[model samples]
Target chain A: MTRVAQISCGTEYSGIQWLLSDIAERVGIELVYPEMALSRIDAACKEIGLRAESPSLNMMMARAVSTLADPTIKGALLLTCFKCSEGTIVKDTIRRYLSDRSDMPIISYSNVEKPKEIELYARLEALATLITRKALLMREKQEGITMGIDSGSSTTKVVVMKDDEIVGEGWLPTTDPLKSVDKGIEDALNGAGLKEKEVEAIGVTGHGRELVSKHVNADLNLEEVSVVAKGTALLSKRHKGDATVIDIGGMNNKLILTRDGIANSFSLGGICGGSSGRFLEVASHRLDVDISELGQLALKSTERHELQSYCMVFGIQSLVVSLASGVKREDVAAAACRSVANQVYENQIQEMEMRPPITFVGGVSLIEGVKKEFEEMLGVDIIVPPNSQYAGAVGIATLVSGI
Target chain B: MKILVYPPNSLILADLVERAGHEAVVLMREIGEHVRDAEIDAPPINVTEDDLKRALRYVSVEEPAGLKGRIGLLTPLLDKAEASVILSDAPPTYGCMGCAVADEFFKFLIRQRKIPTLEIKYEGKEKLEETVKGIMEFLVQLPKEGEISEKKG
Candidate 1:
């Protein structure tokens, strides 16, 4: 007889959690656990059978691991919900504990959607069980694969990987993410030359993932921030040490810290609607210039003026006044750069006491002036990865492969 | 050029001055904060001649705040012109006070034999303009010699 164990982070009446429980019941996987602390897993298991314990995450995942060691257990699954970062730590800890033993299969998942896609959920559960069962036959060895999709307000990305190698990557404007996500998935799938059925599991990450996932489902749904760290780890071949990802998109900013290929602490902005990329786009259109030329022009500025306006409307007026006064365009450019760099510095950098090498990601990261201004303002080197644009997609690919 | 002047507190009025192409100078920094604060509520506050003088000196003479010390600020500038217009975009009580102050100041200039041919028009709008026509239509009606003289005393 096969025993399958399911584990999940506690849900507080979220729609996704209810769907996970419903799907588990339909798939005939016993929903044997509730949200608990690390210490409780041992006691939960003593009532059933022996299980493994997670050293990092508290009692939430202890029962699943302890139970996985039983020869009678055929498969195991880990479940999590959205707005959940602690789940990553739990998954990482469990993976580390099960690194050597492959007797019974184990899988990890984050709830993607509700009951309608229960079959998709069942297939993934079955795949996880199959992988675990297959591993027991192999000569003690480990394999990894990952895939990442970063669906942002302005852009969408996809990356596919086989082990550590980046097989395929893509970055495109996020005009209509549903269509773009499909294209991204197709690109990554084709690059890997793996059919939908051949791929053992799928994972998704991003702001627009909820809508994007409707077009394509994943075995796991992860938060965008963790995925960025995962994607950057795979793409940061240019540097040697831990790197910070400064993701400046049309609407928000994220600062992620990665050390030795793991995300430690990360922070994100409150979507206040004003930042470098959006500002540059508006300024360039108003000045009737291409955005690409904005940075270079700002770099040439010699005169400097403080932009006194607190909002965009006021800023526009100030710019007009400066122009009337014949403030050198270079000075205006420098001021513009300073304005954007200052916003980033005040909101993102002030909180971090330690300065680390910064990596610029997202669409805005491509702008030369923003990067130059950030470096000039901080007095530190800014790192822009070659594949920075596709980091999220790459991270998704890494996740798909790693499991 | 058409202009709209909403001299809500007079700073806006000063901004309209340069755009209005008048020789009016708004001594910005010299203007006291209390006078501005008072102007926002009751008509011309308990401002003394000394306080007005102190306020006028530091104003961006050409900016909004420079038009302190009432009508005198407009006297020299009005005298130098062949024609000038003033617009008021406030309630009747406050607008009349501002208009009376300007009339008094214009007549004071005339008493000193500094009066110039000036036209003042008054109208109202939901927003202020900074153009000549807008100014002529919104706040000041054509200045009459009798009204101007009566306001001066």
Candidate 2:
């Protein structure tokens, strides 16, 4: 079948690629990976006098624009991470460029570390619906529904899928994993307009997956890392390349290296909360700003202050002092983001032999300031996928469907 | 009068001491000189060659209980002080473990110097006012020659 072209940040996409693939499959739309369109992008860039720059986002955008220009490709899906530096910087440019150059429908979406599953599913479902409608014009098929429950340390996410099409989704802050799971599932079922019996298979993943799966009775309990890899591989399948997935959560972070669509090696970091979502939370509290607004606030900074302390406890103190010294709050926020990025790079990323296409997943990747700092520090354009925070849950659901 | 304060980074106590017509001496102020843009809350301290040598004199690397480094850092401040305003119940604002060790060593060094000191807990409202007054009174009452004839335990 002729496919919808997907152009995404390589790193972020790897985390939740599986969910997109599943959605595409169900919608009767094949996904044309941007990697497959690199040559076309290069040719287009040369033909249009566009200079390819160091760091891959520009090149990626070129590939996306060129790929979507193809007559066979039905539409384009632009998957971005919340507050992703490159995404924020290039999204408008890509949209404007594509809109002016091509008549293909271009849909843009963002993902964060914490899964906002309901909203994500709704957006994906709409896109799938659109793709399916287009596919119906060319003749296609439909599939059954499957359910996935991700009981995270900080939140719970539930996604109900009809084959690749997301039927319903729900997410809530987790006070009690069991209760959150029950609530999320209930909400997802209601949203999908389906009964529990209609869900052909149920899968669970995340820190609280075992607890949730045991209590809720799931058909499969998948490892969070494996599922993340599978999901990422599915998303990046069109690339036909490798990626190092960095999934930073509230409590822990993971680095998974993928080679030939397989997870080759992985590392975890959580000894200190300095490099996790908790660090940003602490900074937000100290600054007396809402956590959700921190990214936008940080982006306003022209000068980045230096937060030398690696420990969150010490870092907050340093932040307070910096604020007291008349430094701009935005600068301090940016500095804090840089400090977190520095800790992660020094402690984790430095240890790994990172190849191109580094995918930053987990909840922390949602922060634009953090993403920008990571890019500056790593000297590379990091890819952030859509619904990055829900990669594990989506991956588990994919695994369960395979069974 | 030169007054030494515990935790070395309490801006409240330092400002209070300065207002009471005495020079407030804190080791952190000295450490801050070596680092750029050091904040009042948490000063980034880099132990210099001179600091390491001074610290080694009081505590050896073999049995350095972490107290010796603090003692070495605070020795210069303690030597210049005629009195001390110790916030006995003031929790360490930052670096609690290191501050705790420094607190003990500071008290020990103050006793050896026979300096007149007022130790009080941080209480809110009227109690805080009374504590500040008490510290001011104690510092003002010290001999003009900068000597406390009898140290009170």
Candidate 3:
């Protein structure tokens, strides 16, 4: 396992250290707490030359400086508790200090006691993928007959591609991951009118990638960010200088900044049903319409109502209030769509620069109400990549073929 | 009844807790007594190096001495707390306690103390009204007499 340096204070006390270790273990990476004698901490403190009030702050600066000085260290995790003013300053200073000097990739977190599982998985998995599969991430094209599966939280998706073109794809709402993967890959093969053994390689990505990949003995188990970028690049084929890829799935949302076919930076949204397709699912069900018809119903509404909170429960509370006041169903649908788009913007997009040639991929991108709202809010035409919803499966299929 | 408010010393959370007829056990109350004492030479910094060293029992020894110092100050308030009103994920500007490590440790220790704690995740702009209402409801619902009663046999 590749060792990633940990530069933070008090993760052990808050019990986040064990959770970090658990995530690192799950992702097949290791957390390296840079250490020396407690007495030598004074010297480490002196070497960094920081006079921060807390000894922990000083310790973090010392560890950060030492880690940056060491060239062999390929990755580091810089962290600070969100509530610490001094720690934020220290975190920013060291972050810039390291970013300027080191070639190593570093992930920063402003944390509380309970860490979000998906966020940790994405970040550590990104680090793990970068360290392990740099060449695959750099590969520009797909080769041979490869099958890729996205065993996501709410849905399982598979795409079978030959050379550079997709021959077949399968998508199903997820229940049991093992069963879903079994069915999805079979469906894709059936759609392509090909036997399962005909596939040259298999790659998997998403929340359920580990289990599914282990079951299949896959070629590549890549992270969502890299695969999504590759898939978006393949499908978009637009004027491809600097572009942003947005994929809002059933459980959470992702925004990736891309340069050519590769990811430069990415952010996954906080665990909120409001920022995801599940919110729309609930909205569509409550409105007594099929999920497929929600976009058309939203388009018919002349008036726009707003939902107050980005939490699904609170957003639904707002939705209920609007309905109680006898708001038209069309208007409520529009509000629900607009609320989802707004939350995605506020929670995810605002954190990253929205480069032009913004491609809206994933199942949510198919909703015209969402696409229209994204366009209206950003004041730019959003590109809905062809087979946008199949981006992940297609992406992994492309990546595994490169290997 | 004494209710501890996190940020360790937020006047706002303290005031709201007090409005529910409970004494607010905040750092300022403990530190007020520390500043008045003649034994500790450090005026503003109430906890001495030895005092900070003594605080090792609260958190791991691997932690820095400064965080230990901060935890030392909150110990008195923790001892007195019967219930707590903690607004989590608030910006550093909200409390300005300086040490983020100790900030987390304070919350962890309070939770370990097993008081009737109300931890509201802080959301600015959109959910302030609801959060305040949540705090009020939580404080009102806390057992007036003492710890929650055991079920009768």
* Best model number under lDDT: 3
Provide interface RMSD per model, one decimal.
Answer: 32.1, 23.0, 12.0
List CA RMSD, all candidates. 25.6, 24.4, 14.7
Tell how far residue B146 is off in model 1, in angstroms: 76
lDDT of 2 by residue, A1-403 (tens): 5477776544221234445555556546677765443445456455444442322445556766567547777667775554444454455456546655664555655543233444344334434434433322111111368887878777788888786656788877888889899999999999999999988889898878768888978988755665666555554432345577878777777776655434444555655788888889899988889877887789899986898697878988899999999999999999988988888887667645686688877677778888889888888998887776666666667667766
Q: Is the docking of candidate 3 incorrect, acceptable, medium or high quality?
A: incorrect
Lowest summed lDDT window (length 10), candidate 2 chain A: A133-142
- Tens digits of per-residue lDDT for model 1, A1-403: 2345555443211223344445555545554453344446456445433332222123444555565545554455555442234445455455435533443344555432232363335334443334332322111111355566778777677766665666666666677888888787788778877665655556676778767665577765655665665566656653245567787776677676554444444445543445646776776666666777877777776656766652456765676677678887667666666776677777666534333767787667776777887888778888888777776666666555545
Question: Chain A of candidate 3 scores what in TM-score?
Answer: 0.83
Off by over 4 Å in 1: A1-147, A161-169, A185-202, A238-243, B1-153
Q: Give residue A188's lDDT in candidate 1 (0 to 100).
A: 76
lDDT score, residue B35, model 2?
Answer: 52
Q: Candidate 1: deviation at residue A374, Å?
A: 1.7
Ten residues in sequence with the least summed lDDT for candidate 1 chain B? B1-10
**lDDT of the structure predicted as candidate 1:** 0.52
Best-to-worst ranking by TM-score: 3, 2, 1
TM per prediction: 0.45, 0.47, 0.66
- TM-score leader: 3
Question: Which segments of candidate 2 are over 4 A away from where they belong?
Answer: A1-143, A235-239, B1-153
Per-residue error for A18 in candidate 1, Å, reads 20
